[model samples]
Structures are given as C-alpha cells and as structure tokens.
Target: MPTALPHLPTSRLLLRALQMDQAEVLYRLANGPKIADNTANIPSPYTLQTAQDFITGIAEKYRAGEVLNLGMHVQATGELIGMVSLRLNARHHAGHLGGWVAAHARNQGYAAEAASAVMDFGFATLGLQRVGSQCFGRNKASARVMQKIGLHYEGCLREAFFKNGVYEDLLTFASVRSDWERAL
Candidate 1:
C-alpha cells in the first residue's frame, strides 16, 4: 500500500503505514489457527507469497484513497503488532472498519485503542456519514472490540456468511457521524 498514511498514536501503540518489508511479520501474526478458525478469508496456509502479493496489490488502492490500511506497532519497541483498516464508500459517504491483532497482543486493548482512532479518521478526516464493521457471530472478542470502540450493535444476518464449510451468522455494528461526534 501507500508508503505513508496518517500516523495514529495511542498510549501504547502507533498505527503507521504498511510497508512491504513487513509481509513476513504480518503472515506470522495473521496465520494462526485460532485467528483463521474464528474469522473468514484469512487463509489457513498463509505463505510469504500471499503476504507479498497483498502488500504489492493494495498499494494502488491505498494511493487512490480507496482504502486506508495501517500497521500497528508497539511504541516502545517498534514491534509490529497488528493492523487496522477503513474502507471508503464515497458515493454513500460511508466506510467500514476491519482489523486484527496478533494473538500475543490480544486482551491488551490494542485493537480497540487503534480502532477508536480509525473511527475518528473515518468520521472526521474522511467525512464519512457512517462507519460499520462485521464479525462472525461466534467471534466474541471482535464484537467486544467493536463495542469498546463506540460502535453499537445494529443487528445480525443469520447464515449470511459461509466460512470453512458452514454457514455463519454475521453480526454487524456501526456508528454514525452524529453518534461518534457526540461520544467525543
């Protein structure tokens, strides 16, 4: 993706631009069995090639302003910890947030902390009227992160997503600009 994006800072983490050199790091963080089993689309057999392809492929999308993908790093050690992203839908003045943190980094509030900044970027910087996120119904940790970041649970679409040979309930959460602004 783009070599530079808005640098988002939190108490313990820094959300920086995604660099191609981080492909191996990302693959190791995202290719865990627990992560793939709980979410959709993360390949179980994650490879270096997959990481390279993604880093190379998304550059154009990032530069075009169609998407914002950030790399999460520990402020103290500069360790790449995870990622956060916001997808733009200009026509509808909306965007969607998606993110994942390494297993070692979970339960530490990193995801929620980074997500809050991204929500601000979506509503404040991108001028999106609304931003939303989706997680598998059984993905309680992810759901908690969404709620922790100020998104309210809107509803669920039963059997809406098929992952790993089974139909999954998709839980969608969102926050409008007015609500987000009021919360701050």
Candidate 2:
C-alpha cells in the first residue's frame, strides 16, 4: 500500500487500500442488483472476471496517485464488506466520491461514516478545496449519506445516465472544507 493512501478508521469501519485477496468480497458486493442499480459506471451482471480485472487494474491508479480506492472492512472480523474511493483530477481541485456496502451492512450508517472519513482525507489531508458525489436521483440511500456528511445539494443533470435500459437523472452534491468543518 502507498503511504499517500492512508487507512482511515471510523468507529465501526476501516477504509483502506484494496488487496488482491479481497476479490471474493468485491465480487459479492459489486455483483448485487441493488448495488449495480445505484452506480452509474458499474455494469450489470458484474462477473468474476470483472472483479479480477478490477483488482489488477487498480494498482496503476494507486501508483499514479490519481485515486484512492479503499475497501471498507469490519475491524473485528477483518471482513471486506464494502468499498469507498476518491477519484482525483489534475484540472479540478475536487475529487469525486463513491462507495457500496454489502447487502448485510446496509442501513447501518457505515457508508456515511466511512464517507465522512474519506472526505476528511480529501479536504484536510489532500488539501482538496471541495469533494463531490453524484447519485442516481432515485438512490435515496446514497444521497442521504452525502447529505449526512454535509454535502450540499448542488444540482442534477436531468436524464444524465442511461443505465438498465433507462435514462435516469443524476443528482450532484458537494461539500467545501468549510462545510465539512462546520459539520464537525
């Protein structure tokens, strides 16, 4: 793991770099219909090959310092239950955020807490001026996590994503360092 990529801990979760050993957990969570429906970039019918490819390809991103892809794990069990990441850009001072919790971990506030920790890393540690997240307009749970971490409702690109044989609007939310500080 790169030292630039920090392993952040919340009360119930540890957000750290994804290891090759986590392919099984990634396969389970990333393949679920519910998880696929919420993310814009994830293909439906996610396969073992996709998981293996993802594990292999993620190394280049970490090496380049362009993204921080962290697995969300339960410290007690050392089980991989989810994933959270910061997608960086050179032209933009902000990073895009995303995550997915296992079916069994849903509604436990792990997403929000893990998200908060990553946002803190982005703004405080990485010196990003802002952090943003976008969700399918219908993904209330993910949108709620963004709001819980103090990301304001910025705007929505109407009918921006064509997925699952339908076009859905995308809701964009963001939080400045000031907003994050206030939330603390």
Best by TM-score: 1
RMSD score of candidate 1 (Å): 2.1
Q: Candidate 1, residues 1-184: lDDT per residue as tens digits?
A: 2245688888998887777889999889888657677766668787888878877766677678788878889999999988788888879988889888888888999989999988887888778899999999999999999999889999999999988789999999999988998998
Give candidate 2 regions above 4 Å deviation: 1-3
lDDT string, candidate 2, 138-177, tens digits: 8999989999888899999999888878999999999887
The pairs that clash in candidate 1 are: none
- Stretches off by above 4 angstroms in model 1 are 1-4
> What is the lDDT, from 0 to 100, of the residue 115 in candidate 1?
90
Every model: Cα RMSD to truth? 2.1, 1.9
Q: Per the 3 Å backbone cut-off, how many clashing residue pairs does candidate 2 have?
A: 0
Q: What are the lDDT scores of the predictions, listed in order?
A: 0.85, 0.84
